[model samples]
Target: MQLSWSQPCSSGMIQLLLVSNLLLWECVVSRPMCLDIGYKKLFLQELFDRATVIAQYTSNLTMQMSEEFDENFAKNLEYKARNSSTCHTASLTTLEINEQIQQTQSDELLKVMISISRVWYHPLEHLVCEVAARKGTCETMLSKIKELEEKNQELLEEMKGILVRVHPGAEENAYPAWMGLAEVRSDNEDTHHFALSNLLHCLRSDTDKIVTYLEVLKCQVIHNNNC
Candidate 1:
């Protein structure tokens, strides 16, 4: 009359919540003595929704930040010193833009920035690499971004290719030319390729999913090892 917990669920819940491990499972088989099954189910659904929202909000904010940083980096007066007083005008314009974005009162946006910095932002100590990387040039950033974007594009294409190869008409109206353009616009190319950079950052952050997948692989290995 008892059920055993899966190892992954155990490890994930432990690491996911450092305070305490899930305790109500024991009661589930004991006639629901210690908990309300309906309320617990609702609570779990709420938790899942919260987790999804956090992930989505983090993704959107990361993209916005990347686009903003790229736009600022790309067409700067410092980089193009020979231009007119455009640099001064840009400075004033940036101030005004910041004022407007600040007016939005988006706490989630700030949290996204914090999460990104926690993972990616580093204070430079030495720069012995090269001049091109010393300054975050458009060409350099763009190239780096293109690498990831190409990878992402290839993955998407492969997915669609496989689906089409299998079903032949699986993606006719589903993925029209406009859909492709809309997806391309989803790239951060518009505002100085910051969108691309943001995507790269997201891919790096989500690399843990790869590890999670590997853990599943490891589990399979261990299970086979025991057998």
Candidate 2:
């Protein structure tokens, strides 16, 4: 008697798969180059840095204004809230006790009760007015902030255009710091390349980490608003 065994796949099938995979790998390895840093990366880096700095400064200013407004609003609301609660309690107690009184001057007692009633309800009317005004003002502020954000985006695009025009690769020789500004002021295309490269370097330099700081600030503002 003889015994036979069955396998998942034949050796021939395994060899064919290995050959196909090797061919695919070779094709992928022989592909063309993808990215060239050249001067483009430098220019973008510079633009990003400058934009970051401006963003941070604007965010800081807005935050300070918001904090001051919030503090004052909280103080005003707290005082008003406490006063209304106290007045409401006192008025209720007076009305209940007055009902139980055995004897008192009829006309005088009625006048006093009417006065107390008015005082108790006066704070509520004022509170309603205050709430309405606050809602209107908040709506206006939101509109203004939206406008500011749009303008900021436009300005950043303008900065990016300036950066692209000044790419160092576009120019062979570099100019001194003074010439960079002079060229930009004169609107000369020749010196623009030099100006851009210098600008990019300045933005990414250790001494000018404004972009990093601004990114942090923007994130904080977004988080605070969400909360």
Candidate 3:
């Protein structure tokens, strides 16, 4: 799969999304930074909460499909999958993302997270049309990713573009992380079903990563930059 970034979004969409999810953050003037951190945390929690739901839904869906499909075929499929990377076949995996990533390096992480979220929006429209997914589940997944990506953009902007916060002399800039939101091109039903489930698996992993990173940042903020 091609693990790349760069989603084409219009300025108007940004404005509309931001407006819909805007927080009453002006209280920053009255509240201390620590207090304000809670609000941001709450907002992020709200944004990712639906993602958690979608992840669980997909997990259950995959299990159901396994039961519905031939047992031997499913076992063979899983064995082949195990030969490859787990969670997602994309260049980025749960292990790679969680390993060696520091909280202070959030600027770069946010940039990449934004890209990952954007990469899904366009292709999701097409994914919803494919029979690989249950209609309701896929549609919900599509809207939630779009909504949270836009909401996340608001947080990134509020944090001053999340660009300059790199640790004062850090050597590695491994930012704009690889996102492999590849399209489903298979025509066979089984292949398409497998491909769509794979997409959901990756998406669930992505959502978990976003929640993890944001929680780390929330810790840093609430702890007076101690993290």
Top candidate, metric TM-score: 3
Root-mean-square deviation per candidate:
20.4, 29.7, 20.7
- What overall lDDT goes with each candidate model? 0.34, 0.37, 0.47
- lDDT score of residue 55 within candidate 3: 35
lDDT of 1 by residue, 69-147 (tens): 4465535544233222121111111112333433322222222222322222111011111113324545644443433
Model 2 CA lDDT for position 214: 30
| Model 3 steric clash pairs | none
Tens-place lDDT digits, model 3, residues 64-182: 43343323233356634633344332443222444445534455555555455545554444544543344334444445544443543454343332333322333322323323333
Ranking of candidates on TM-score, top first: 3, 1, 2
What TM-score does candidate 3 get on C-alpha atoms?
A: 0.44
* lDDT of candidate 3 at residue 162, scale 0 to 100: 30
Question: Candidate 1, overall lDDT?
Answer: 0.34
**Which consecutive 10 residues in model 3 have the weakest lDDT in total?**
166-175
- lDDT order of candidates, best first? 3, 2, 1
How far in Å is the alpha carbon of 178 misplaced in model 1? 40
Model 3, which residues run further than 4 Å from truth? 1-99, 132-185
